[model samples]
Target: MTVSPLVWTLTVALILGMLVYDFVFHARKPHVPTMRESAIWSAAYVGIALVFGLVVLALWGGDFAGQYYAGYITEKALSVDNLFVFLIILATFRVPRQYQEEVLLFGIAFSLIARTGLIFVGAGLINQFAWVFYIFAVILLATAGSTLKEALKGDEEEEGDSRFIKLIRRIFHTSDEYDGNKLFTHLNGRRVMTPMLLVMIAIGGTDLLFALDSIPAIFGLTQEVYLVFTAVAFSLLGLKQLYFLIDGLLDRLIYLSYGLSAILGFIAVKLFLHALHENNLPFINGGEHVTVFEITTSLSLSVIIGILVVTVLASLYSPRGRAMSVVSATEMLSERYLQLPADATDSQRDAISRKLARQLQRMPRISDSLKDELISDRRHYMELLHEVHGEHLDYLSARQSSDDTSSAESAELERRKTAFSDIVNPAAESVGSAEESVGSTAPEGSSEGRPQHH
Candidate 1:
């Protein structure tokens, strides 16, 4: 467990190199990775981790190597659990498949940094205080209970409305939609955060909760900070590829939560046993060393690996799992269809359309009749959009024409009234003048003229 400065430097460099390679090659271009691509990358990363374990075995003794393997297995299992939350976040945000890699990468980076700090603090506290193991055990036991409850209910979607997300919404001016992969975009003249940003924040917040269990669990396996850190780093590497490679498999792994609960429960008992063995508390066995059975690292590692295998096998063969597969596939496609943005580019739309069509064709329960009907509906939707667009244009044109006709008619009516007013006013003035002149001439001799006539 004695890690030299040289070893530390080399290890950090390797991890950084792997991250950079992932970024430059796999994540540089945004695309839905093909299954083959995901499989190859996932296998390669796992292979690298196995090789690293072998190197640790050669450098250190068998005990340290065993501890490393156990820690890695435990962390890897926990990482799978973390994936459930990741899927929820992605689906809740309706992240486009292409940008999902970016989101996961950001999440992984944030988790790594945050875990490193937690590891340091945890190591320091464990060195100073032996009771931390008891606390860790209690926490892991509680987490196991929580995990078991969630598994029984199958309620990963509850993470979609996490308080972290609500807090962010309250604090920031956020867009109701994504702006490609950008975390921030200009809406009008103000800056607004996108769903991408919100997802990353959610991932970070969840990772913090996960670390509360993971760090202590690893500490129980080995107090060597180097082993704990390396195990976590290796376990988390290439998780993005694993996410894609096993995307469909996740739903089928219905027993994973149960397996995880068992693992956590077992580890918690181990931690408590170790705490008893090294008891320093006044109330516990009169502060004396208790003769509790200590579980070896090899046993712990074997149990974890065995549980994971059994869980996977049981899930794949279970009737419920089989039923869920079809339902999950349908739900995934439905989400994709619903999430297609109205303002998405044509290429983006076509990509999603083709993806949905392929998924529909691959579904065994979906009859050919249904497939054809779904395809027909897709086409009909496009046709309806075009028809609606044309109708909207026609309606606008008719409205403009009616407005112009009304305006012209009003102008003609006003012009006719003006002409009539001009002619009538001139006649009225001349008649008034003629009446005034006749009255003026007759007024002087009106009585005398009238009498002679009589």
Candidate 2:
């Protein structure tokens, strides 16, 4: 008797137990999670999955363990690739950093249920008919086609309702605005579902579409339902953690599709082979098991690790092109901050942030004091720049002119003020980087760190 079912049940229980731990105790009493917190938690989540995989292998003999792990690795890699789109979705909504956690957690929760349903249906299909492999293979290839389009396609002229979303909206009335990550609520004294629910629904639905690729790909590796589900579940459980950790890094992995495409191509071939093995075709039916190159569980494990490492390194070390992508992203974020009008979503904002980050990066090289001064008064400097026109800045000296001030102390204060006159409007920068600020230089002026009143 195969122990697959029991093993998977226990594995699922363990997963839910951890998730419950996080929900009840761990994620509860937090001063908001910082980048540091994101990094730590992400590492912990991945580490748990890895260590857990080893335990699965140890307890269930080598074969089932391999099947489970191979499936898991494939799912995890696909999940990471899925995050690039999440980055876009979040940016589109302009989700706040603090509230982003709630968004992703909600998304992950709904996705787990949806994917579980998809997996069960898929397993049932495979059990019932041999021709289902062809259906599965076609869906996977189609998904790969769509994914390639998403990866390679440039900005669309506009966003539209997805077919599924449009259909849902057509059938039922839904509200447009978010209700603080609340899925459903009352509006205008009537019960209404929130866009937050729609967004989660969109995400969960898209993942189901993606499952068309992922489920079939893993099924190529294992016929065991328990192994299949265990791997898919484990992979998904880590997604919210990954989203928190890597939202900033998404743009860097610009070539993520190439990697994913290679993975898909690899799986597509595997599915074709598995189809060949089980088919009733005249020549191949009852034919001997044709061994392809030795692709073992250990190799798949190593391949997964290698792919993740290389993708990350390639992204970080690739050309510094992420600047505009991130800035473009910054512009898309309008839901939370109405800092910019719709038109301000241009390349200028991206350039400014990139320039500022680069300046901060180069601070040590120029002069530590200069660096500190630049950073410490960043907001103040932005403000001054905002107040003065280009011509006005041109008139000021390296220090505010002594004549420009009414008193000696005032002159000193004015100088300080000039140092920071460039600073203004932090809230405004949220929607998009204003072009006026990106390249605007401070006027040369004699200045003190204090502000001098005009």
Candidate 3:
């Protein structure tokens, strides 16, 4: 159904108005928003979108607008799912709370450009070949099935050193710490990249992978390039804020992908039917021509809402929405710490252990089994005792005894950090200090890879 020219003009005006409000009122600062502030802004954005949908219903007779809104809602769902990985990346970076805004802003902007390009590619596919819809359907179906697999298994922690990342690390010089958002730094007449730059590439590269799932899913919604582009564009417009607002809620949305897959499967079938209706081909008799699919705006809206509700409810009610057994090693270390030399006060021992645990947790090589056991694991307790002793040797040992042979090792780490700094990542303790890193204990058993987390 065609809408009046006046309605289109009004919709454009509304879209521009929201952009103005966002720029003027919401995005004045590059700072992290508090929970209350994030909650209010998120609600306001959703309300604005909802109000626009209602206006679409009233003015355009709910036909074209319905499809647009459903597509927007679905795209928004996929964008939220993107945030799940964003959280992991952010936490891994240990980005200072204040600097996260910059990382997120950069990420959102990059994703918008990337997804817009994806939308056009998707539109081209469906337009060029009718059978492309089935390919998209199968892609969506496989991605949807992956949801069940993902739900059943936890994501394995990938090592930071990917081959590409390693090659880049070898190829560039980098800074030791963040140089206040500069992607690269130079020291002693040698140019170096920072962790920030590598992180940015990692994030952009990762988002490109995520787009594989999302582009297909949104295509399942609407084949019209304009509708698909606008819907995806608008859904992503507020994503940086959405990341902070729903950061905590994401862990609770454990079944989120399943919900997304279900919606995509629904939309895939809808688009396929729409394709069949418009097909001029005769060779494929399986294609049934129907003028209109029953998929209206309301039904699409219901599916989106139902998926969110069920996802949230399932996560909330999940019996194992927890680490099978988990506790911060820091806390446990503080609890059982005994003062050396027997007469030391409790406060001193606790302080020492807390400081040491913080230093240790920043190291990545701890076996998860040992990590999961906390202070309760006798083996882990023994390792800590050796590490404390190792720290002493590290401080007193001769500068000549150990190799600092190449400043290249330091240079390489700088390059990795510089390269990755644009994306927030977990803090990495310096590894050049062999004592802090290689502090080893006589193992009760063969300790290799990651000790099994039980």
RMSDs, each prediction? 24.3, 9.7, 12.8
Candidate 2, 272-334: lDDT as tens digits:
666666675446545444444535666665665576678667756643333334332332221
Give the Cα RMSD of candidate 3. 12.8
Instruction: Sort all candidates by TM-score, best to worst.
Output: 1, 2, 3
lDDT of each: 0.74, 0.58, 0.59
TM-score of each: 0.75, 0.69, 0.65
Model 1 lDDT, residue 367, Cα: 43
Which candidate gets the maximum TM-score versus the true structure?
Answer: 1
Candidate 1 Cα misplacement greater than 4 A, ranges? 334-454
What's the lDDT for candidate 1?
0.74
Which segments of candidate 2 are over 4 A away from where they belong? 4-8, 25-32, 155-177, 184-187, 283-294, 320-454
lDDT of 1 by residue, 1-454 (tens): 6899999999999998998888888677888898899999999989998888899999998899899889988999899888988998887787888999998988888888889999999999989999989999999999999999987875655565688789888988999888888989989889999988888888888888888889988888899999999999998898999999888778778899999999999999999999999889999889887998999988998998999999988888765565456445544544554454556564654454445444333344434443343333433322222222222233233434464557766565445334433432232222234343233221211222111110
